[model samples]
Target: MTISGSCFCGAVTYKIEGKLRDARSCHCSMCRKAFSAQASAYALVEQSEFRWLSGEKLLTNYESKHGAGLQFCSKCGSTLCGTYKGMIHGVTLGCVDGNPDIALDRHIFVGSKALWETVPEGVPQYEELPPENA
Candidate 1:
């Protein structure tokens, strides 16, 4: 299955060629500030299976002091994706075109979550990134 998405102004578009998995919500302070939301939802995709169909030139990347870099549409300022020191890309689900046929498996960085934010019940919560085996 393939999942597709674009920025608010449709300037940037992307396609995920394979199945998406390990979806999660991040309540980290950096995420909240970067996304301008209480939390950010994302799904993991292999770099080989992901493609930027358009607007590659319009993507502007910002690397925080913590070494976390995010890519967003320069025209619309929409958060598109993020990359760590790995081959996987974390695609923000909010910009996705449709239902990704996945569910949030866990909540990460809850320890740094906003005081006013309340995470949903029944979902696994972690004070930081999940264990490698999780």
Candidate 2:
């Protein structure tokens, strides 16, 4: 399915084609701090299939020493997505419009999750990366 999304201030926009892959929630500290939420939900899209539709100049990026790149809107500073090691690009699920009809398949880094939160029922939870690396 094709999906489109924009940042909080509409300073960044994009279109993604093909099937969304590796939908999951990240409870890692970096993700939690970057999103300022209990957890961050994302779907992996190939770098080639991800296209910036507008306001490209308003986008700013920060790279972690570990090779994870966080892209956000310069205007509102909303975290849009993260690109890791130039191989996989993860689009923040909350930034996508209209729900996108995709359910998060699992929760990763559950060990780092906030103490007050509970994993959703029936959704597989992993203290670390899944065995299949999904």
Candidate 3:
């Protein structure tokens, strides 16, 4: 399935030609701050299936000390995707156009989630990074 996405100002756009995977919600302080929300909803995509359709030069990226990177549209400050070692690692669900066929498989860093934010019941929750990621 082909999925398309763009930044809030429409200055940046991307497309994913394959299915998304490892969908998850991250409630870590870093994530909450990055997304400016209770948590960040994301889905992974293979580099081979991901491509920037336009406004590549208008994107800015910030890399965490842990080596994870979040790329945003410089024009609108819209988070678009995550990167690892310079390759696309995942797409931020918020910027995804329409509805993509995916759901949160896990919630990570709940231990650091906002005190007022309550994770819903069901699925799986991790105090920190999941074992597979830790």
Candidate 4:
């Protein structure tokens, strides 16, 4: 299956081929700040299956730290996606155009979660990153 998405102003667009992994909500402080929400939802896609469909030049990359960077649309400042070590590509759930046939898998970085925010019921919650097998 192919799933497409774009930034708020349509300045940046992307296409993901094949199946997307189950989504996860991240409660890390950086994620909260980047998304301006209690958490950020994302689905990981294999590097080879992800492609920039348009506005590649309008996408500005902010390297938050070593080996990781967030890509957003320069025109509207929409957080489009992120790259980790240039391997796995993480697509923001909000920017997706339609259903991506995926479900929430778990929540991570709960230790940094906002005090007023409560995790959704029944979803697995982890203080930090989940185990490799999770």
TM-score, every prediction: 0.93, 0.92, 0.96, 0.93
**lDDT, residue 7, model 1:** 99
lDDT values for all models: 0.89, 0.85, 0.93, 0.87
lDDT tens readout by residue for model 3, 1-134: 99999999998999999999999999998899988899999999999999999999999989987789999999899999999877789999989999899999999999999999989989799999899888
Ranking by TM-score: 3, 4, 1, 2
Ranking by lDDT: 3, 1, 4, 2
Task: Please provide, for model 1 over 54-107, each residue's C-alpha lDDT reduced to its tens digit, 9 standing for 90 to 100.
Answer: 998999888766667789999999999988743337899999999889999999
Candidate scoring better on TM-score of 1 and 2: 1
The global Cα lDDT (0 to 1) of model 1 is: 0.89
TM-score of 2: 0.92
lDDT tens digits by residue: candidate 2, 12-79: 89888866787999998888888888899998888888888998898888888999878889999978
lDDT over C-alpha atoms for residue 106 of model 2: 92
CA RMSD per model (angstroms) = 1.7, 1.6, 0.8, 1.6
- RMSD (CA, Å), candidate 2 to true, equals 1.6
List the pairs of residues colliding in candidate 4.
none
**Residue 45, model 1: Cα distance from true site in angstroms:** 0.5
Could you tell me which residue pairs clash in candidate 1?
A: none
TM-score of 3: 0.96
lDDT of 3: 0.93
TM-score of model 4 (CA atoms)? 0.93
Model 4 spans > 4 angstroms off: 86-88
